[model samples]
Target chain A: MGPLIPNEIITGQWDFVIALLIGGAFGFVLEASGFSSSRNIAGVFYGYNFVVLRVFFTGMIVAMVGLLYFSYMGWINIDLVFVLPTYLNSMLLGGFIMGLGFVIGGFCPGTSYTAAAIGKIDGMVFAGSTLIGIFLFAEFFPLFEGFYYANNLGNITIGEMFGLSNEVIAFAFVVIAIVAFYVTWLIEKRVRKNMTEYKFE
Target chain B: MNTNSSAKRKPNYLNPYFGGVLLGLLLLTTFFIAGRGLSASGAVKLSVVTVVNKIAPEHAANNSYYSKFIPEDGGSIMFNWLIFGAIGTFFGGMFSGVVYGRMGKLRIEHSPKISKRTRIIAAAVGGLLFGIGSQFGRGCSSGAALSGTAAFSFGGLLVMALMFGIGYVFAYFFRKLWI
Candidate 1:
């Protein structure tokens, strides 16, 4: 009964308006959480801070649980919601490359924009180069087109892949995330004590 | 280090878990209303499509990837909701920055040992790589790694795992840039 837009319960210009509002909230939370700082983001890898991992995992678990609950309560129709399609080889390679970028750049597309908005020159540079990178991909699409389309898994969920219930998978994920949080907290404390150069700004 | 003024002026960030919870709620609300999660890189793809179509109408129409996004009716590709959402992200970030007193003159962020020029180049190159990678991966951090994992998509999980995993794998090599 929910997913008002796809179900036509909400239509036309108002849809885009709501999208803007949602995006606003998304961006606001990101910036307010210190995502506007490149140093904060890079801290996850260095062990001086684990803000990125904590925020990301918490958000994922919370949303996942919220969706399952909403569907169970019949407040929303989960089937109508969009699930990102899978392209295995492309994603694995792409993710690897992006990971390298994250370490070097200290920002992702979304976070970089937020940082740029707050006047971080590095953030602005990263954001600008993204457009160029995208353009390059489009320009050279023919070369890797086959690789991109390889191993099409077609809208599969992890629950289905592992033959687990969504609830079960979600539970497992929550447990893993909590453990990670605790481990990272200890690591961060230790690292910060030894870190003399960078202050958690 | 101007500790007194810095401490007095700089607003403390919201607790990370609280911020994540707020973000999750926002994400959930989006699904409830729009039936989709938040995305950042998808919007950039649209921007790329729009720009290519404008600069070379023929070229955009000719490409396999670009043509997929080009409207049959020849409308603007920029009309997508993701673009609007991204614009909102910029404004929202700005608003938050102002509230937190984080807004300031443009400055390149880097480690003390690194030259500003080196950091800028690294950021640009890193961004370039991420942009291309997102196209291949179908999304970036928010769309693929975060939202996808939430939806329990295997690709999402894989991307999230591989991205962070590989980052750790290679972090030491790039430690100079950060640490």
Candidate 2:
């Protein structure tokens, strides 16, 4: 009844059209939320603006809870949904490198694209660099080929990792996110009071 | 540049909580309809493969990396879902910009302390790291971290934590670029 494309409830060019619409929603939400600004994004770290933390955690928890409800209602087969495969060491190393990039560059791949779309030169440069980085990785594929495929944990979920049900974990996340949001709001107030260099744009 | 300074004082963005709810619902809809969440880096990867395939057909054919994306059907790699999603992202961003009056004018954003040249250099270097990292991590923030965490994937959680954790650790070092 759901996952219309995979379930054959809908077929053909419709999926492509849906992809565009979904992508649009994704982009609009991101840009309208002030994600197009590097300063706004960087503020999450400095505690001046907590928009990134708020939006990111909220989005993740909402989807997590929604998936549970959908599965419970049998509206969609949860098993059919794509769960990203985990490769421990590879992701750890990759995530670390990306973290450095985020602090320095001020945009992730998705956010940067949205930034670039609105005529931000910095966003455009970041996007172009991402291409160069990918090309470099491909060019040096032979060197890291072994490491990339190492630590293959296959498709695993946090529920499996923690031996808890998805609903329980999601509920826990909701609680954690609320606490974090409250704490960050407090921190942002304090940090903004002392800041003379950066202000919300 | 000065015209932009006068064109708009500031953009009125939506409330974070409201925007989050909308984003969350969109993500939920994606899972319900497509059996997956959103992504961005995958499109970039595809474009890289396409370029390599075209520029050096022989090298791409012989290489272990580029060859994987070279379709046996000789179809366009850019026709995939992620690429289309990215294309939509462009339009969606523009739509929001126009509506919010945030569009029009290009500028290199950076701290007043840093020159435009320095800002561009830092951004490019940062972007390159992200690009290479995504390949290793299997996705970037949107794909691997955000979507992955939503789906309750272990790898997603790991990437999210480590990425943010490292960002905080290194943020101090790169403070000048932003602050």
Candidate 3:
């Protein structure tokens, strides 16, 4: 019933307009939460800042619960929602590469763009290089085509794959996220106290 | 530092949980309306396709990956919703910066222990790596890790775990860049 665009309830022309508003809110929240700062982003790895983890996990669980609830209430059709397809091997390697990039660069693409918008030179550099990096991938696409498209799991959700209810999985994530929040909070307190350089605002 | 004002108050960020909730709600709204979550990197890939097609029509038309995005009917690839979304992200960030008073002259952010030039190089390298990785992974942190996980896809979960897990594993090796 929902997903106005797919159902033709919302005209095609309005799609881009909706995207802009959604992306704007996405960017606004991320920036206000200090995601525009690379140091704050990097804190998740060093234990001095768990803001990234908290925000990511919390946002995730909220979306998950919201989706399930919407579906249950018949406000939306869950199956119509897009689930990212899985190419197992490629994604694993990709994650590894990005993980290394995260530590060295201290900025992800989204945060980097936001930072660049605020005139952070490092953010600008990172954003530009990503374009180059993507260009390189396209240039060498043939070499990685087999592996890149291999092991496709085909938009499968965890519930469907594991025979668990979506509601159950969402509840588990909520619990895990809360536990992680508490543990990370303690870790941040201990870590920040020892760091003479911790930015106190 | 605000040169215009005499106030020395440090930049105050929104509460993390509150920020996360806001982001979560926005993400939910996106899915409700568009039936797809937000993405930062997918838009870049689209732009890359458009540029390559324009600069070297033959090359983009020949490539397996780039060709997939090239329209057979000669439609413009730049009109995709994701591109608009990316532009919105830029303006939104600018708006937030203006509100928070964090907008400043171009400056390289880095650890005090590192040189500005070194930080620049690091950022360049990182961006390049992330760029390539996002392609392989089908999305970056925002699309794959965040939205993917929310949808409860195995690959999304796997990528999310590995990305964060691997970051911790490699943190010490690159501590100088951050701490």
Q: Where is the poorest 10-residue window by lDDT in model 1 chain B?
A: B1-10
Could you arrange the candidates by DockQ from highest to lowest?
1, 3, 2
- Runs of candidate 3 with Cα error greater than 4 angstroms are B1-10
Root-mean-square deviation per candidate: 2.0, 3.2, 2.8
Predicted structure 2: lDDT? 0.90
Candidate 3 chain B superposition, TM-score: 0.93
What lDDT score goes with residue B57 in model 3? 95
lDDT, candidates in the order shown: 0.89, 0.90, 0.88
lDDT of candidate 1 at residue A121, scale 0 to 100: 93
Q: Over the stretch A1-201, how does candidate 2's per-residue lDDT look in tens digits?
A: 777778998888888899999999999999999999888998887788899999999999989999889888989898988999998889999999999999989999999988999999999999999999999999999998889889898999999999998988899999999999999999998997897666467
- The TM-score, computed over Cα atoms with residue i paired to residue i, of candidate 1 is 0.97
Which 10-residue window of candidate 1 chain A scores lowest in summed lDDT? A192-201
Candidate 1 residue pairs in backbone clash: none
Off by over 4 Å in 1: B1-11
Clashing pairs in 3: none
